[model samples]
Structures are given as C-alpha cells and as structure tokens.
Target: MAILSPRRRRSTALTVAAVAGATAAGVCLAVGSASAGTISGPLYRDPSSAVVRWVAANPGDSRAAVIRDKIASQPQARWFANFNISTAQSEAAAYVGAANAAQQIPVLSVYQITNRDCGGASAGGAPDLNQYQTWVSNFSRGLGNQTVIIILETDSLALLTCLNSNEINARNQAISTATRTIKSANPNAKVYLDAGHSTWNSANETANRLRAAGVQYADGFFSNVSNYNSTSSEANFGRAVISALNGMGLSGKRQVIDTSRNGGASGDWCGDDNTDRRIGMYPTTNTGDSNIDAYLWVKPPGEADGCRYTAGSFQPDLAYSLANGVPNPPTTAPPTTAPPTTAPPTTAPPTTAPPTTAPPTTAPPTTAPPTTPPPTGNGCSASVAVNQWNGGFTASVTVTAGSAAINGWTVTITLPSGAAVTGVWNAQASGTSGTVRYTNVGYNGRVGAGQSTNFGFQGTGTGPSTASCAAS
Candidate 1:
C-alpha cells in the first residue's frame, strides 16, 4: 500500500475543508414525508457480512440482540470494492442475483480510486487507472437487469487536492469511464457519485469536481458515506451540490444521504467515543426531498472508521453503542387503535377484473395502499396493506383484538405465488408462499381489545396482492 506522511494527509483534509467553507450550505430540507416503502428499494442482504456472522455465531449473546435489531436486521450494501479483482465479476453477479431473487435492490460501492484515501486510514486501491477501469467494467457487467444502486468511489471528489493535476485528470477519466460502462451494461441501474458529506467539502467545489468526472450520465451523487453527519445537514449539502451541478447544465440529478450512523449526535465526528455515534434513520425512500432520493446506510453501523479499532473492522462495542444509543422510532410502538384495515375475505380476495362500481355493502378494491376492511367476525382479525414498487412490495399486517386482549398471536397469511419474504420487522415471520406465518416477538405480544400491533414484511412481486389472513 502506498503511504503518505501525516503532514500530507492533514494538508489534504485541510484543503478540502477550505473549499467547503465557500460553498456547501443554504439548501432547505423538505418537510414532505417519503412515500412509505423500504428505502433504496430493498437493500441486498449479504450473509457473509461481518454483522451477520456475529449474529449467527452468538445468537444468545445480549450484544448480538442489539446488533441484530440495529444493524444485521436492516438490508444494507454488499461491498465488492475491495475484494479480489479476479473473482469480482462472479462475486458481484452472485450478490446481484441474490438481491433479484429477494426482489430487492442491491447497493454496490465502487471504491478503488487510483490512490484512494490519499494514503490515509483506508489507503489501498487498484494499482492504476487502467486496472481500475477493467475492474469496474467487470463489476458492471454482473448487474444483469436487476435494479441496483452504484455508489462510485467514496472520497474521490472530496479528496482531490491530494493528487497532482495529472492524477486528478486520470482519476476523473477513470470515474467517467466507469460510469459509462456501468450504465451501458445495465440501463436500469442507478449510479451515484460520492460527494463526501456536508462537513468535508463545499457544495460548489464538489459539484465542480463531479462535473469534471462526468456525473450527468449517472443518476446523481451520495453524501455522508461512513461519516456521522446528521441527515438534515447532509440533505442540505446534497441540495447545494445538486443545485451547483444544475447551474452547470446538469439538471435532474438527485442524491442519497448516508444515514447509517448520526443518531442525532451533532459534533466530534472523529472521536473515539463509540456512543457518540448511533444508528440513524432506518433506510427509507421517504426522505421528503425532491432532490434527495433516499436515506441509506451506505456505511453499515458497527464497522469502525480507523479509531476505536482498525478501520473497516466490525467492532462489537461500537455496534452496541449504535444499537442502544438511540431509542427505537416511535412508530415501532404498537398502535393504540387498529389502523383502518382492509380485511380481505377468509379466502383469497378476487384477483379477477374489478367492476367499475362497488356492490352494495362491499368496499372498493384498493391498490398501492390496501384499505378494504377485512371480514371481522373472529375475536382476532388481521388487515394487510401494501406499498409496492417495480418488482417488490412492503406488506404491513395489523392484527387487532375484538372481544378480549390477546396475550400471544399468530397470524398466517398466504403470499402471492412466486413471491418470497425478504425481510420482516416487529415479528418472527416464517414459511414461504401459500401459508406464511408471523408470530409476535416479546415486545409486541400483548394487544388489548380494540388495540392493534403492527408488523411488516418485504417480498418479491409485481404488485400487492390480496392475501387471506387468520389471527389466532
């Protein structure tokens, strides 16, 4: 690995800071709510990720519980940027294929800038521009037709002062070439160039570098990768950067902010205190900003950033702090009253063509947001609502007690044929198509009369389908 002196590293960081002071602010955070759905589409779940292994090896450990809920449970990016180049194509294909099978989008970080990190904490990268181009080409080809998000070269735009003019040009050319290669290979894939974060570089400075690197051909840019900047701060930074790019004729570009850590902490980004960083917003597409596409965990929590432990290694202590640091979102609590539920019939709701007018005493068929009330007779009733995207949908089940409180509940649902459950929250959901079962976890077991408990699952399908649900 190429190593630079401490002086040189500090100089590069200082220069980037100087540029940021001139630009990087004034954009507003939209008050709009992101339409409810898994953010960044469904994230690719990598079984080999360090957190997954930690959860698997120590299921009984208390620390594992926090990591599971906070980190392992959420779908995040599967990094292929630092793996063996020779096996990269096949490995990337496997990761992409798995995501497609789950009917979720995969996030791939395209690291390996010619001299990545300017020889700082995370320094190593591809040997040269030519090799880097080849690696990206191979990685892009593996995406197939599945929808994917490509986060290109973290720190490339933010740390440009570390390179000489020739190196900068080469790096820009390499990035431009890689973007073209990835897009040409799969038009459905969304590519995001990295714009560092709000605190690092000014919006105009980063936008200018991104233009030189040819960001127009890709989707947009990303911010706060592996950093602890608040979502509002990064969203403002992204808005400024995109506005700058638009000034230069690059319109329609949007951005994704890395919200993996920033559990509301405001300062000391590089401190060794693990509790200083906490898991941020759960991945969601409802960022409420038109310019901001989604809030994603670009840098999965629990992974250290060169301080408490070696950079990039999964640290358990850090993981605990991130998990327990912030209380779960208020939405996770059970609802006081059952949400207006669309209770389908005891049997599957008709999938055939619907009549223009509703029959007497029957509700209209609902799409996108299932709202039809289910037939309510049993002491327990379940209502399923769905929010769908291209190849996947999130189905939310609200089980309510009618006559008496339910101490423990099991709701069985029939999934649409060919669909697989990718992830579940607030409950233990098992089984495949035909008869999938969801049982309450400890926290949400007791539901008083007229009250509701909410649990959701993500699955692969063209759109939401009527499911037959029974609660016991």
Candidate 2:
C-alpha cells in the first residue's frame, strides 16, 4: 500500500481575516492573521517590481501582457528595476520617474556591483570589489529620493560556503560601501541588506556578516528574500538575528523581508517546485518584531529562475496546485486502546447420576448473539477555497475531524492554466511536478485535527479555476 509522507498526511485548515483598526493595529493584525502567528514591522507595498520582468521575458505572450496590465492597473502595485547597473540605469531612471510622477514608491533591487551571477542559478556579481563599488555608486546616482526600497545583492553574504574567505570578505566590503553610497545619495531611501532566509544562516553568523557589512549604516537586514518560507519562520529567524545584532551592539535597528515568493518553505534544499503559492496580498502590515520593518514583494509570481520543475518555465498549473492544497497519500493510523476482557462464567455438573445416560443426550443451552462492530468515525478533513478579485486572489478554508483538533496544517494551491501566481501568504511555492505547489512552511507541521485557520494571497493571475484542500 502507498503511504503518504508524514509531512504530506497532516491536514490543513485555512481562515481569512479582514483588515481593521488603526494603522498600527491593522499592521499587527494583518501580519498575525496567518497560522504561524504575527510578524513584526510595517508592510511594504510594491506591485510593479515583477511586472516589468514578466513583460520583458514574454514580449509576445498575450497572457503575460494581460497579467502585466492587471498589475499596472492597481494603484498600490508599482514596479522596480533589478539588473546590473550597466543594463538597468536607463530603465531604472524611467521607472523611478514614473513612480514618483504617479505618487507611488518604486522598490529597486541593486545588483551588478557585487560578484553576482558568479555562482550560477541566481548567482554571479562583480568580478572584483572596486568594480562592485563603482557600479553601486553609479546605481545610486539614478535614485533621486523617489521613495525606493532597495534589496541589496541577495545571497551575497550567505553564499560564502561556495566561496573562499578572501572572496567572502571582498563581497562584504563591496556591500558595505554600496550601502554607504546609497544612503549618502538618498538619506530618505529605505535600503535593506539581504540576509538570506533563516534556514540558510544562523543568527550569530548572519549578525556577524551584518556587522562586517556595516548594517548599522543602513536600515537593517532583510531575510527570506526570493525564497519560499512562511513569514512566521522568517520572523522568528529574523528576530534571532536582530537580537544577535543588538547583542553585538546594534540595538533598535529596523529591517525588512521579501514576502514576494515564500508562500511556503522549500521541502528540500533544491528542486521542489510547488507553485500553488503566490505573492501574498500586498501591504501585509507589521510584524510585532521592532527590528523587522516590513514584508515586501520582491519576486514577481510566475516568473521562473531557470529551474523548471513545472511548465511554461514557471508552471501556472503547479502554481494553482500549490495554491489549492493537494492531498498527500494516507498514513498508518495511531495506536488504538484495547478493551478489558471479562471472566469466564462458572459451569455446574449434572446432579442426577441415574439420569447420566439421559443427561448425555440433553440439548445444549442457547447462547446470545455476538455484538456488532462500532461505526468508523470520520477522519480529519479540510477544505481551502480561493477567489480572484481585482488584481489579486483571496484564500479561505474549513477543517473537520472526528478524533482530533486542527492545530496546524499547510494549504497550498497551484495556479490554473494561463494564470501566473505572483505572491501568497502563510505558505511557499517552488518548481515541482510541472506545476507550483504551495505548502504551509512554518505551520505545516503544527496543525492539529479539527482546527481551522485561514490565509490570503494577492497576485496577477487568471484568478482561480478551482481550489482544493489537503493535509500534510
């Protein structure tokens, strides 16, 4: 018999909450609304950050164009240019101006200066330190305080395992110099250093890098950028790193995280494409952590980074699958309790010896009929529903069980055909099985039976054709 993986058998329950209260309270409740609990800090709003790339990649694809228009139509959604300085300067200038003209903030990812594109698969930067600094200086010149959130060089510090000590040091220096240059140019600009996700770097190690990179000079460190992990885990991990930084003498600092892609955490180190996850609704509000400034959408949904576990390179079907939780195979039942046994009834011998011959021929006494087995009770069941409204999607689900309470579970959805998931919440998605599978990352292992929790996702898609639910 095929048994579902333990992680796959647990059921998922979803719940959705509305935005209410003051700005601060709204922020707190919005972030806390998910199953992993609330995250701290203000929510970053950026919609155009990924649309440009989608348009550029699929110049002729009508679906991409439609999604792009949908994204652009939203006043809250704005674009940011992420490219090597040499390639992005002109485009960045145009976008920056457009964003300012529209009275919106443009979130930019400054690449090219560091040794980016060096490692491959979202790797490689400047070949040398001086060159990296030069590029950042030029990149900073283009920003004229138009309100931009810069996600400086992702994985540059954490990828040290793939580099030598000297190389790592050089990269750190470049990042520090770049941060200083950007701040000097635009004091009003919100610049956040990329501190890879929690699973990748421990607090001590991440703090050490932050210190080396001069995190004090900038706002703070960014975590879970361009990765698929829930905000809860990221928040916990982010808090630990912030605490470590404070212990290292940098206290009361603020930071931000990229909630763009992590609707779910990666099931493995590599090659787990579960696309049902999407860009969580924009402006996710504040986490309670004083150090965490905001959760921003940096990675556009549906765009693939070359790893193809799904179709269309990005796999809309997989994205839908992940968005709607897919059922995993079943598992062995828990041990059952045994009932007590009764004592045997006493038997008596026949009294009459003279009738012994007749007694031997006597008929046996009648016996009571056997008891019937009890009806099997319903096992835990959960259902997640998703709907497309305006330029994004909303998700909700219900959980039921006979013997357990739904404490924690993951609900993932895959994007339908012609739809691309740009963001999600309380879950994560990556390339998997020719589709994207969204799974609850931090809360996946915690949901108990019969308990229900709800989450929401905001992204550009054809909306949801069908939404399903499963445990695990």
TM-score of each: 0.61, 0.53
Q: Model 2, range 172-269, lDDT digits (tens) per residue?
A: 77788888898898886777786766544467877888888878887777665445555665666677888898898997666566654444432221
Instruction: Write the residue-wise lDDT of candidate 1 on 270-367 in tens digits.
Output: 32233544677776555545676666777667765443344456777778877885654333322223112233212111111011100100011122
Candidate No. with top TM-score: 1
Please, what is the whole-model Cα lDDT of each candidate in the order they appear?
0.59, 0.43
Q: Which candidate tops lDDT?
A: 1
C-alpha lDDT of residue 122 in model 1:
51
Worst 10-residue lDDT window, candidate 1: 1-10
